[model samples]
Target: MTISSQSARDLTANITALSDKSVALMHQRSMSDEAVTTFQNILQKVQEIHDPKAALRSLSAEELDVVRQAHSLAESINISVLSDEGAANLLNAPGHTKDLNNDGLTTIGEGNMLTFPPDNAPASFKAAWEEASDGLSTMDIPTHMIFAVGLANIGREPGDLNWVNPYASPDYDYGAAVSEIIESVEYQYNHNMMSFEQYQKNMSFYNTLTEALA
Candidate 1:
């Protein structure tokens, strides 16, 4: 089903207000344990929805809307608060890179690959790329999907490239697909590819939902 533009706008507004309130609470509480636990629970709920690729099929429209808003919020949180060092560590972590080649990279479809920044890349670029890549990997989806979404965030359209999934699939998992899309959004925000207002919108959406859910 398609969401109308007005409905989408209204949903965004509601989610944004919720996020604003949550952030205010966090600021007021200085991220106390209670506040942190609440945030973690909300994130856990989002992760649970995205972890099973098939779970999405059962959701109602309202549930799906919440899922979409939550995904955006999760992306913002991952991009804004997840540190470069944290991201790099996840990429280089033992067992994480087993799928990667000697250079710590893996290919997705559409002639795109996710990799640790080369030594020649600027330090800032390397850090951001690693962070984005790391965040993408944490989604517990196929590596290829993660790569495609990351590329998409950078303005590379997988459909335009006639991208083919390298992994065997009965069907594309919608939950995983959405997870990747959210990761790509995080990548864009982390890299400053999105406008500040856009970034704030995402963060507010995420923070507020997190607060309310907490």
Candidate 2:
């Protein structure tokens, strides 16, 4: 029902450190600006930790079963996947006009529910799954089922459909959240907004400095 705490100290450290950067990103504005490239790096890290088969493997049996159920639900719908070109172009489009800094950060315990187009739901889920697959079949059912779903969703709605660990909640729509991160980074990368030297560096102060903090 919970993420594998194989090394509670390391996992806590990673999550605690990553959480601040995630919050800083939540309020960053100016999708047109070069900071967006940093946003891209952050997004990459999130999917890096959560999507790959290796990341999925880190999940508890119950957590993965929950994700598998979500994967199956997503597959049941006919997803109108965009071609590579279309997806590439769409990912680079402009986003919110105004920047934001609410002067407050949101912990996982708190978030606002977001809405997504029904038409795009399946594709978004598929994209998340694909990013997680890392060339392996994400749909391969494992040998056993210890529990039906994670305890986090024990009393929730029948089909909230957001089943990836930690972020799976009725309050926060992970798919929509990912679209925002993707579009910002894609815009900067596609437009050559950051210099090669700068682009190659991890510019997010929060992430880079966290090790020092810890």
lDDT of 1 at 191: 97
What's model 2's lDDT at 32? 27
Question: RMSD (Cα, Å) of candidate 2?
Answer: 23.0
**Model 2 segments beyond 4 Å from truth?**
1-168, 193-214
Name the top lDDT candidate.
1
Tens digit of lDDT per residue, candidate 1, span 73-146? 22212322322222222212111211121122332111223543332334544344344344333532224333
Which digits, one per residue and each the tens of the lDDT, describe model 2 over residues 7-80? 22222223212243433443343222243444343333434352223343454554433322322222221113
In model 1, where is the ten-residue run with the lowest total lDDT? Answer: 93-102
Candidate 1 to native Cα RMSD, angstroms: 19.7
Per-model C-alpha RMSD: 19.7, 23.0
* Index of the highest-TM-score prediction: 1
TM-score: model 1 vs. ground truth: 0.20
lDDT computed for candidate 2: 0.30
